[model samples]
Target: MQHSIPPGGRVSGFRLAKLLGEWRRRGARHGSADLAAAVRMLVLDGRLPAGTRLPAEREMAEALPVSRTMVSAALDQLRAEGLVASRRGAGTWISLPSGGALVGGADTPLVGSSMVDFARAAPPAIPGLLPAFDAVRARLPEQLVDHGYYEHGVPELRRRIAQRFEARGLPTSPDQILVTSGAQHALALVLRMLTGPGDRVLVEQPSYPNALDAIKAMSAIPVPVAMTDTGWDLPGIAAALRQAAPRMAYVVPDFHNPTAHRMDAETRAGLADLARRARTPLVVDETIVELDLDGDPLDGPPPVASYADDLVVTLGSASKSHWAGLRIGWIRASTEVVHRLVSSRTALDLGSAVLDQMVLAELLTEPESGLADRRRHLAGQRDVLMAGLREHLPQWRFDRPGGGLSVWCELDAPVSTRIAVVAQNHGMRLAPGARFGAHGGFERWLRLPFVLPPDVLREAVRRLGLVAAAVSGGGSVPHQEVEVPVA
Candidate 1:
């Protein structure tokens, strides 16, 4: 039997035959029920997703060495079960039924649980984490014996965080602070407090995927405002706000994830103005603000919240700057907004861990704390990864991101998904660019983290180079001769 595999899915005709043959060998009936079950398992296991078009009956029958009658019968059975749906002239599509319609049994592998996941945006832990944990242990007794776990958050920690923000030029008050487990939780609390389900929210295109997921989880509509390689498209953002009339907008102004573009001062001011004009709340994620990898870290400009007090919510997290396991994050907003957020947060974990907040407070107040060590370590790692990429896979085009954990690279071809699969086979994980975009765009790009150690990053790049060569159908070539400009 011969089958024509889809473009992105390179499962060959022979492979399909083998899969079907194995199913037959298991003594399952060769009818449509059995075939539908097999295909359902594949879809549920993430090998296929909704809207994936199956081959034509003639093509599938030829590939499976089955009669066309059998192919048609199997498809009909699948359609009846609502596991597959067909449209006239558009061909048949495999779709999971909406809500509570369980087609497969408990033994089937779940969609996200079965893949070799590289879509995570988390950075590796700082080298100081072990020592930080030790330090936390030395002071755990007092925290454990404390009676009340909720004073909003530990007082000492809140004070320290406020002081740290002040040192960075953003004046904050401890009364305006509320600690949370992570940035995601903080964002959720803010969303729940500010807007209701079905309210519209504006987000940047090719932004953080988890933000989109959170918005959708709240049943909010996410209107994506396109951004550019140079910086935020202020006019585009304004247009999106005007058209969508969103209740809020989420912006990652400093060293944005996936894109690595920083919002310039002028753009920041314009955005604040835009939000004020639109009467929409603006949430700025400053998680990657302090990770400057380029020249001298000049405190560039005031935070967006500083520009517009009533309409902006500034969020910060120690996860990116310090350790993800620490799970400490805060929001610096007006007292009114802080009170509302805290009120909404009562149902969500009753406040953050008391001991973790205390530890963060100690780290923030210490003159030569783990935060300083983290900054220095990340700078060195970024340099190491950049140098390795320069020496190895220079055909890929990427800028030296000024301050961010990852470098966004544009490949010559739209094969990021393919390259990711091949790299995983070679023991390297990769984030395909499409995962960062809505409507499955950014197919020609990749996001590579420089947060790993020098040696591990070097090895990963070597493996990535080999995978790129394989995907490109060419042998390794000499590094492209280009001047390495200081970012």
Candidate 2:
């Protein structure tokens, strides 16, 4: 195939050489699997437009200083995957399948059927949950022989949860709490009670995608405010409040999802003041506050709720701190708001499972409950995982978050979806960054969960490094030699 360099451009640098070396190494070890996966992802994510001509094998190999054989293998793999097609004297070109072509046909069912998913933000169930369940079963006969299923949740559970919040500096009363199945359910009920179709609500950019979907499903418009690496963009948020005049602002103030940036007390107070001034309700998701990985719990500032008033709707859950299977989460608000939510919840489900509520109450009230141990375990795991990433892929940029389940890493190039696809082929599922964004930005980011065991995390990062090198066009070399760009 004949090729010419793009006008006013020339490719020559150590960067080019490193990219080629990385690609070659990945091809030799993984046999063009990663490169092909990258090509397919580029097509799938619309980064490489349909009919875009690919560089010739010999030219790419020469430019990158790799063997033509490796380039040929990569091209062949792409051809086999139907992502690219070659014609006589035309070289290779991308071919994107239309939306209808994604499934077997237009009639194929693809919406609700379960696909291999790594996008969920919740953590795996803890081992202690089973014992808690057994204990609940043993004590159920005495607790539930006389029945009362009302909206205030189980009395014992409410008191225990309120006490836990109080310990964190968020004053609460049993009458102000209403338990729901999970955090998502709680958020849904709150939205149902507070807002309606055509109402405007504020959300953060790269916010929880499922929550965005929920808002859309309810016919509400979501106004996005940007979040920075340090924390919430208070100026931008205030501007959005003024411009959008949203009915409510949903925020993940503690150990936020996707970015793991916690809002400081000053920002929290400022936001509360803004909400109060604008007459906008603020919904705070504190689901991950108990997952702190840095310092002793005694060192951190008071909980976010300590800075807000009746305008704030604080949501907490046992899912992240304890076990997701427990399906126990609660909303803390004024008594009036609690009653409104409870009344609205009656149409959704009769009540949360009595057994699970009782189990959570018992667990939270335990003198030596499992929270401290779990925190210690998570802290150890986070260190191990971060160390692995630093050792294996130094080119990527990431923040060692204070507390959260995942690390948000930014790749040197906009090829994270490709890397995820390649990793999945090697038996490692990844959450691509675009899944976190509202309008499909963040193509250069990926979320890696550090909640896995150290050994498993090591393996995952090793495979991930291999994938990153391949996408970066770096050929075979030790991970230490790979030039991963932090920016």
Q: Best candidate per TM-score, number? A: 2
Q: For model 2, how does the per-residue alpha-carbon lDDT over 214-323 read when each residue is reduced to its tens digit?
A: 78878899898878878788889999999999999999977788788887778888888888889898988888878777765435666655766679888888888877
Q: Per-residue alpha-carbon lDDT of model 1 for 53-95, expressed as tens digits?
A: 5677887878877778877887888777677766677566554
Candidate 2 achieves a global lDDT of 0.69
- Model 2 is weakest, by summed lDDT over 10 consecutive residues, at 100-109
Q: What is the Å distance of residue 87 in model 1 from its true position? A: 60
Off by over 4 Å in 1: 1-124, 127-139, 295-298, 474-487
Q: How many clashes show up in model 2?
A: 14
What TM-score would you give candidate 1 relative to the actual structure? 0.70
Instruction: Score each candidate by Cα lDDT.
Output: 0.69, 0.69
**Residue clash pairs of candidate 1:** 1-62, 1-63
